[model samples]
Target: MMNSLDISEECNNAFDKILKTRRSIRFFRDEIPPKELIEDIINAGLFAPYAGLAVENKEYFRKFIVIPRNTRAMEKIVEITKNIMKVKSEAFKSEMDKNPYLKKKGAAFSKRLELFADKGVLGIGTAPYYIVIAEKRGFPPVQQQSLAHCLENMWLKATSLNLGFHLVSATAQMAEDEDFSRILGIKSGEYEINGCAIGYPKENPSESSRPETKEVINWIK
Candidate 1:
């Protein structure tokens, strides 16, 4: 029979596995996650800890916009993203001309952009669902930290649900474009923090490299 300590250790191990196994999947199968699952994931964000005693009154601080598969909106997003990539590629090349150190990196980046434009190789593929996480404009640093906490919770929830999750930062550039924001129905004075794509994975992604804990952490005491 297992003791309470053993049960506690088991729980810790399980949580560790979840953290280790969560990968940012770029490709996904064309299946839409169920409505209930999406709700559960959003609820996980809702329950995340926020700053200030007025937490109950701060619902407006965070918002989630969901885009389902193959809709006109999704197509618009994909097109806009492609245009943004093109602009980024040009900017990368211009910077490479001024900085020799960036030449190698810029070449690789431009190659990827070519694949994305010509071969349809997306950094974040056409996942069945996309959730745009937005925050009210002019939030202070603490509240912004709270927004990040909310996203981390949603990511963990997606991992626990056996779904592929990819955070799409490229969309933030699109959010800045006034026309694009209008298409997405984001009014003025709101900032798009980032986006998350969710779907069944096309393949299991390999583990990414990470720096050793000792390299990144220090103990003063």
Candidate 2:
């Protein structure tokens, strides 16, 4: 017979285990997450509290285009993403050349693009599901902030569900570009500010590194 203290200790241990096992999980097993489970994660994000005001507004007026697991669709997305990264790198280099002050930052940005290029679009060739979270209206003050907050909530929910989420800022840039924008049906001009790749963890390769602590957090008594 287990007492209340023993049960509580067991629960705490289980929770710690979950946290320890949780990593970026670049690779994943080949299995599609259930539709209901995905919906549940989104719903959790939708219910997140607003910044301050009680404005009841939907994040996305249009439907989220869930790209199928087809090779053609995946290849198209990868190609688009690659081109977007190239364009951004070129633009950044051009800007740096004109402004000497921005040279250091430009070099760093170019390096990131090169590293991401090494991995390509599907993120280590493991992510099977690509969720393009797009919002309709890209204006105003409150609405924009609200939408960003919604995205943050969604990312947290994804982590809690043991799913891998990699934000391809370059993909969002592609969403805004002239040619690719048409594919997303974004009013022929609107832009997607963010994009995330979600899927189960794979096993081909494992483990990714994160930066150690910076001098950001300091507790006061």
Candidate 3:
């Protein structure tokens, strides 16, 4: 049995470990973590604070689930996603060229945006597992930002396990593509807002950059 003190100590240790090694791993080993472990991580996300948990009488709340695909299969799916993005990039470039306002953003910005629309998505390359979290908005927008918090927990948890993880919100591009949706069993109008790529880190990684917490925190009494 875990006493209060023991639990607190464990929590602190987990947090320290997480902060130390939670790098956004872009390169992944070929080995995949066990499917059950992946499911366990998603379960951790389900416990995250959301509107559903905030109110006992709320009429609606969102349900979440994760899908675990092997590295090879995920690679194939990513290829399809890349093809769709190429078409989207061409369209975006054409639109930006037509609008003088967009042109003012600078060629580098537009080019990077096009590249993001092209290859910034690392869903399959980084992690052998893909965890997609979605919700039903009842056809109208509702405050669902809480889902992000839930995902953050999963990302951090993966880090604690010495597994690398990063959220790939750019999966939204694939969400809009019909072919991609069909492959993932996603329906229209449903928000597949985010996905996380998770796997073991490579043998040697570049030094990580650590940001000062003060930049993100503002104290108000």
For model 1, what is the C-alpha lDDT against the true structure? 0.73
Q: What local lDDT score does residue 19 receive in model 3, on the 0 to 100 scale?
A: 66
What is the Cα-based lDDT of residue 2 in candidate 3?
60
Error of 2 at 94 (Å): 1.4
Ten contiguous residues with the weakest lDDT in model 3 = 135-144
Worst 10 residues of 2 by lDDT: 51-60
**Location of the lowest summed lDDT over 10 successive residues in candidate 1:** 116-125
lDDT of 2 by residue, 1-221 (tens): 76646668677776655445445445556787777767766675566554342232544453455554556666666666677777777787788889987886668777777655555655523476666655554334243455566555666666668776665445555545665555555554453445556677664233434465465556688
RMSD to truth, every model: 4.8, 5.9, 4.2
Instruction: Please estimate how well model 2 matches the true structure, expressed as its whole-model Cα lDDT.
Output: 0.59
Assess each prediction's global lDDT (C-alpha) against the native: 0.73, 0.59, 0.65
Judged by TM-score relative to the true structure, which candidate is superior, 1 or 3? 1
Instruction: List where candidate 1 sits over 4 angstroms from the true fold.
Output: 1-10, 49-57, 98-107, 110-125, 139-148, 205-217
Ranking by lDDT: 1, 3, 2
Instruction: Give a tens-digit lDDT track for model 1, residues 104-199.
Output: 666877777666555443434478888877766553445456667777888888888988888765555555676567766787446645678888
Q: Tens-digit lDDT track for model 3 on 21-125?
A: 666776678888887777677777877776543433354454443445554446666677668667777777787789997677757755654676567466545
* Clash count, one per candidate: 0, 5, 0
